[model samples]
Target: METVSVAIASIGRETLLDTLRSLAAVTRPAGVDLKVLVADDSKSGAATKLVTAHPIKSLDVTCLAVASGNISTARNALLNAADGGWLIFVDDDEWVEPDWLVKLFDCQKEFNADVVIGPVKPVYPDNTPDWLRRANPLYTDWGHRGKRLYTGRGGNTLVRVDFVRALKLRFDEAYGRTGGEDTIFFAQAAERGARIFATDDAIAREHVPQERLSMNFILSRAVRAGQSYGQMRLARHPDPLWHMVFALGALAKCGVAGSLALSFRLFDKARSFRMRQKLSLNMGKLRAVFGRPLAELYKKPD
Candidate 1:
């Protein structure tokens, strides 16, 4: 029987309970020994307490008290604890479908892929702003189904344990607090000849909270994404000339985007917002290229 471990790294969010419940309700695949692992990053051990109080009888669940504000630390804890041939990662704010595991396995088998990535759909609240709702910037594009990808996110992914062990892949501690650890990890895996493929059937739904609905949050996230991409590019190719070339390209893009945003501000609000987001992203890339410190977006208050 193939052993499979589903892992989650959390900061004690109330939505984690719902995520656990969804996992308990998934249809287990035949001949698969499945287990669920949760790494509690909350210093207070809130997730550990919650799991102890309300156990899922249908699933074999284990919670580890990591107590680290760093997401990479929590994920590394999961990686160390997992005793499975395959590992699946899902976010605390997201829930999977009944056939999520089966679909991921099917894709892996079909493509002979080392890493299989699934799509994440955002569930917006009714009270969300109309413009934000219409724009839907939270939705991720993983390209078409069965297409090969150079990198993938950790939110909804199935990884072959043998491939990971072979490559000695681990999330970078430098990006632990600032996000993009997954981007760097997957990019490294792909660079080392890991085949990454995407599947359309295995879907995870992420719940968007009220705190993330603001324009400020959206633009900030865009900047963070750009920073991650810039950092990853530099890490892959450490030539000083490459850095200068990328920085110049980002500067030109930023100028063009800023001008377009100013020109469309009065007439096309949505287009203007998108242009502004693009400008912020390029500005973040510039910051990364110049070795500026990144904002710790995931750090918990002391």
Candidate 2:
């Protein structure tokens, strides 16, 4: 490994301090060069102040202040600024175990994978609802150790910097707020035959705020995710006829799932939520097949 940069983009000051503190605990083997790059996308530039007041230990850190908002732009800035051979991206609202980077590195060495993926579990703050905890909307896939994966979240992944740069793989700015930039970017890499693998051992934790406890919020996110999935698929085909066929299949799936979800609602809250979620996702896909935008979940809340 020439160098590995842990890239993080933070908008709010709400979670940046804790995230940096957690990174302070990261343990790396001797002679393995590692650095941290944090892009502060907050209007107030709070991340810089926090870093100055309390420096992260043993690691050379670069604090960059980019335009406020636009996560994809922040990530792109991080990629452009990084001089490392590998880039490991983690969300600013999350924390990693001391061995998180080590596990990702080991997985890459073993599999020769171009993209090494990991897991992220939700850490609900106090007063989180019981149902929301059970729903676990924030959790990404929990793949078996060494399992190969083509799709993953950017919150926890180690990407080959050179490969990405060479292929010009980047998070789409159009999705700076919609939150599927990672999906689209990774999907593009996979389409180009880039090897993406999963490491169940490499884990991160996303701190779920109390506001996200709303069932409405969770369902809305799922719907947007489904729409993004469909949009990506349609982008590949880009034919009106093909979109119509895909829309039919998606609509049928949504119909069946919706019926079952309605039935499940009377008896099982968990099953109903799950089914409703599935239905919502397919519905988003259904909407996308026809070329309409999904509900803009990332619109600046006014």
Candidate 3:
């Protein structure tokens, strides 16, 4: 009978309702209690109305209206109100597996992990490009696989209330606009020596709108990666020379392999295609090295 408080900061009122419905659908194990807290950061009072309209049968949900658009601020507001032993965060636009919370709690207890990062797979209702699907693993960092020790999206993470409160960790408002607040928060935790564990059992499905499938959205998303890469490197290593060396070395390796792949078609088509794709990705990483500040991308309209 462990209690888990799920805190969600919602901006879009329509999406909030959908999230609430999803939470209501999750079936918890006996003796375990689930509490859902929604910090509404919408200008209009639509979120309040939507929460009241919905009849959630499974979990106890509280929707509080707050006049702010910053995700970190809204999340902090929820944290202040939550009373459960563990705090779970989810995006308003995403829904979780029925056993998501149960799996998370189990892993948290087993690993004694300060933070648990779960998988977030994009749920596309319609047709989606193969390349986009293939890029999922590349974009998401999890389980100590990448340079970023903690890489799960904010939507699929569970943190111990005491640890978070002790460290006074809050999502960085700087990344609030580009939606990298989760990244900054995890980085802070990692820096503070928090033990983060990645779990696939606690799964969530993020609904990707059709609009985000376009090339413009894909390319624009690149800016966030670049910004995160730059910030992460700067935070860890202050040496500018090493950063340049690392960037140049990565570009050179990709360039050599890319040129060879184009010159010789001896390898299988699938293998060759993958090499070409790698070349393109390496080029993108290089571009990110010189891209403008992270704040600049926040200026562009989504």
Best by TM-score: 1
lDDT of 2 at 125: 81
lDDT of 2 by residue, 1-302 (tens): 56878899876455767777777787785567888898878777777777778776686788898854788888999999889788889888888889887888888989999999888888988776676567666676747777876666678888888888999878888888878788889989999888899888877888887777677888889888988888889899988899889889988988988998899889877777888888988988976776676554543311
Give the 10-residue window scoring lowest on summed lDDT in candidate 3.
Answer: 293-302
- For candidate 1, the per-residue lDDT at 285 reads 95
* Candidate ordering by TM-score (highest first): 1, 2, 3
Which portions of model 2 miss their true places by more than 4 Å?
294-302
Cα lDDT, model 3, residue 194: 80
Q: What TM-score would each prediction reach against the true structure?
A: 0.94, 0.93, 0.81
How many clashing pairs does model 3 include? Answer: 0
Which rank order by lDDT, best down to worst?
1, 2, 3
User: What TM-score does structure 1 among the candidates reach?
Assistant: 0.94
User: After aligning candidate 3 to the native by TM-score, how far in Å is the CA of 36 from where it should be?
Assistant: 0.8
Each model's lDDT comes to 0.88, 0.81, 0.69
lDDT of 3 at 188: 76
Report backbone clashes per prediction. 0, 0, 0
Show where candidate 1 strays beyond 4 Å. none
Question: What C-alpha lDDT, on a 0 to 100 scale, does residue 198 get in candidate 1?
Answer: 92
